[model samples]
Target: MVKVQQSKFVASAKKLTQCPPEDIAEIAFLGRSNVGKSTFINLLSNHFKLAKSSSTPGKTQLINFFESIWIFKEEQYKMRFVDLPGFGYAKVAKTLKEEWKKDLWEFLNCRSTIKLFIHLVDSRHTQLEIDLQVSQMLEKLCRGDQSVLKIYTKCDKLNSNQRALLSKQGLLLSTNQNLIKSQHGGVETIRLEILKKVFGYEG
Candidate 1:
């Protein structure tokens, strides 16, 4: 089993160049405002308070990096998880939004240590225009490397029928083959899946 041993805040960067040097593999989370990105990070890390969760949208304004140590089969591995500012519906100044967009683009394109990019979508809604736009961008950027994963969040809000339907659409995480809904095994499933994909962890 893969267990998170230590997780702590690393650095907050407003621009790509200001980000810490590429020393360890990083996995980034991108999504719209109030999409539970922060909550997801905290849950997956098994550290409920590691990432601040707010009911208000646009609370995370910077590129927050968390350095975590995971032990898999008695071996230690260090990884970074980046929480980028939300894309749509943030009640922030237009200029701030533009700056965030610029920084995000640079981080996605220039970060060599980024091993996977998790694009989160709300399970209660269908794919939106912003999601498509981001998908196209990832297509151009990631090319055919399979470096992108679309994760449907808040699956507990959906009924069994809805979850089954979503699964048919291939909206579920491939590693767990289920909906990552609420505070359950969902977080652990995602954590292990990411480790398996990025670090070749058997669990």
Candidate 2:
């Protein structure tokens, strides 16, 4: 299991211009509104309140940062989990959506601190246009380096069979397809693989 030593809320940003300095390596979470991005972060950290989670859609309207310190082999390191606002919220204006999109793009493309992008998708939804588009953009930005990992969230909501099927489908949709099908299987397996791939090994 990955261990989170220290987890705390850092700041929120409405634009890339307000992003924190690119000192610590960062990993971002992306998904459509109500996809459980915050919940997943909370689960991983073993802190239910580490990131704000809400039942209502589009509750996260800005970039939220959670700083974590991990210790392994008596060595300490810092990392950040960035909760990015979800797209495809119809209630928001087009210009506002565009602005958020621009902020996301700038953060992904220009931030040297960003090492990986965790693209979350609801397990109940098999196909998503916005998710696909984000994946494509990340693919282009990373240039085939496998910098993005698709995370199928809300696994607890699915039965065994449904989970298995969704896991298969998620792997098929990922940029580095083979990683999702390795010795360990399914979403939980994929999550560990991602931690290893991005952080050089799970803490």
Candidate 3:
């Protein structure tokens, strides 16, 4: 059984070279600004302070790495969660925003440790042009063996019927857009899905 017991902040990298040596599998989170990526990190750690959650969009301007301890049927493994800078609508200078975009593309194309990409979409709205661009870029950059998961965040605000309707949308077929709320059982469900992806667990 795979179990994530604890997670801790590791380091922030401005570029791929600055990232810690690629020694283990990494799951990177990518999304638009204010899409609750940081909150998802905290949820995975089960520690409110694990990843900084800011009210202001674009506060995460670098690749933040969080190391977690994974126990799979008593065997320990080290895994990483990378919080990539959000792509759109950051309150930064145009030049800086472009630089962030460049760095993100470089990281995605060059990083060897990345096993999966967790792409987050705000469930309250339909997909945006940036989201499609991201999907296209990942399709080109990620290796054939790599994986991607599409997650719709802040699903608690939607009614059951809305969620059901959104879940069946053609665009959400890959990861099935399982609507996820940050609070309560939703976080745990998200975490478990992540583990399922990592460990190839059916349970």
Candidate with best TM-score: 1
User: Which candidate, 1 or 3, has the higher TM-score?
Assistant: 1
**Alpha carbon lDDT at 111, candidate 1:** 86
Best candidate according to lDDT: 1
lDDT of 2 by residue, 25-90 (tens): 788888888777777777655578888865567745788988877555665657788888877664
Of candidate 2, the 10-residue stretch with the lowest lDDT total is: 171-180
Q: Write the per-residue lDDT of candidate 3 for residues 76-138, one digit (tens) a residue.
A: 657899998887767878898788878888888889888889888887865689898888888
By TM-score, the candidates rank as: 1, 3, 2
The TM-score, computed over Cα atoms with residue i paired to residue i, of candidate 1 is 0.86
What ranges in model 3 sit over 4 Å off? Answer: 72-77, 169-185
Instruction: Give per-model TM-scores.
Output: 0.86, 0.80, 0.84
Candidate that beats the other on TM-score, 2 or 3, i.e. the better one: 3
Positional deviation of 119 in candidate 2, in angstroms? 0.7
Cα RMSD, each candidate: 3.7, 5.4, 4.4
